[model samples]
Target: MSKVTILGGSGAVGSIATETLASSGVFSEITVADINFAAARKLVGKLKGAKLSVAELDAENPHSIRRAIGGSAVVLNCVGPFYKHGPTIMKAVIEAGINYVDVCDDFDATEKLLAMDDKAKKAGVSALIGMGSSPGVANVLVRFCADSLLDQVEAVDIYHAHGGEKIEGAAVVKHRIHSMKVDIPMFLDGKFTTVNLFEDSGKALEEETEFKDVGTYSVYGYPHPETITLPKYLKGVKRVTNLGLVLPPAYAELIKGMVRLDITDEKPIEVQGHKVIPLEFAVAYILSQREKLMKEAGINQPMGCLKIVVKGYKDGGKNTYIFSMSSRGQGMGEGTGIPAAIGAILMGTGKITEKGVLPPEACVNPMDLL
Candidate 1:
């Protein structure tokens, strides 16, 4: 029985990925490894069968990462605040020479991870990055258009909206805060440029597009890795952009307000005779306000979509293809987790034999993912 290690298995995306991988029967043994064993045990308790086990892993510790994922056929890294943990855990995975999959959405980390392609190849590791919903399924959709739907792919625009998780984690909130604070990357006019999300660059490109079955919502600039990596693989494509939101427009604005006020600072400050990290405080406050904000906005359940627009010339005339992947009732657990789980399956089974770092568009077959 091959063992599958799910780091951060106790968290939002990891729990679902654990279930998805186990249900596939691809790996006979599944280890739910997290920093918190009790939380991992709590999640595993509700899951059936003997194929599942739990382990404690300190993702920040290289030795701990190796200990957690060592001997596993494929490691599905659902651990996030990808900006912090993504590269670290991936480095450990590469050193261990295990097949790897991760939902790494942060572009900066994506750049660092992709740069290790040669090392991954030397280690004979088949690594798939950003296999989550937006970057994951979204990349494959563009590949589908480039491969089958379009003669000349000129521009690809991606938009997504999700969130409304049952409980919001501090790491998740910090990731969102970090995304807005940084200079985001976008591909335009055949070159790459960085734009501040709160500045004119982000505002000018804001879009209001309807996601099939998920209603129309305003999506703003996102630093999702697709914008950076898609341009590399989809040659001749002149433009690529990722616009996104976390559902309940009210929630989006609320986070924006926090950013505008510079309340997301990671540096600790003295507050009422005590020390508190601004980002930490913001996360706790956001979690506290989430229920009321969600209630007010009528977001009772999780809903999300990956909407892609590919435009180009065909037969010497203008052409456009619109594709949408919308999900309601179920949320990130399925939308994001299942894809990462499938990526692990592919890597485990040797179906994806490309040795090196790769995005889904570059390695995964769209038909198989579909």
Candidate 2:
């Protein structure tokens, strides 16, 4: 029996992923597991076909994760701010001996997950990490270029713009805050390098790019795993860069403002006799302003695009391929979640059989995923 468990299944991305996987009809049973039982139930209630169920899961607790995953053939982790729960959940899933997939976009998390490849191999588990939009589809597209279209792929540039979801969760905001504060790694000139988003190193690479159907916007260096993981797969590639922006430009600016003003500091500080983390206040305020900013931008609904630009040589001459996936009423949730579901579907169908922690490009076939 094909049973799949989705952790964080009620979340924006997880919900979409759950819908996609459940509707595929490949799984005999599907479990929607989330910390919020009501939310999980609500999500499951909306689905029509397949054996759908809900489980209360506290991802912070490995035991809870394992219980929710009980005997599922595959586990799809849709949890967010992956830096926090990624490695923890991965270890738990690996120990359980079930094949796993996750939309882990954090470069640090990817590095940590990849480090556990040996353990996953030892346990006979196939773990696919960064199976979301940028790292997932983006990676596969580049692999396609290298394998079929190009004689020698030299560079890859991945760009994404998404926002306008009904709600911007705190985990999402924390991830943005985390991205801005940390050193972003990018593969350049066949070597690895890091850039600080707030500094000139990052700004130097910023440019205005038009996303098909999603409008034109300025993009900036993002700390996505594609920059780190792609280099390992696309050998001899001189450069691989990932740049993205959340919609309404102002929304992104607000987060950047918080980072600049030091409002995102995690260290607890005194606030009128209370120990408060500035980051919590910053995230709350940013979310409170989301609706206003989105409305001001005339975005009444979710819209987004994922653009991948691959450049290289075809028959010893330079060639370029650009792939774009965009939607008017859907945004990051669909862009990221759908690919994750596809990865799980691949796992469930025996398409991905490698037994080790892996990135999308490492084990997934581009044609199969496409």
lDDT of 2 at 325: 92
Q: In model 1, which range of ten residues has the least summed lDDT? A: 45-54
lDDT of 2 by residue, 84-119 (tens): 999999999999999999999899988999999999
**Top-scoring candidate (TM-score):** 2
Cα displacement (Å) at residue 41, model 1: 0.9
Give lDDT for model 1.
Answer: 0.88
Off by over 4 Å in 2: none
TM-score result, candidate 1: 0.97
Q: Runs in model 1 with CA error above 4 Å?
A: none
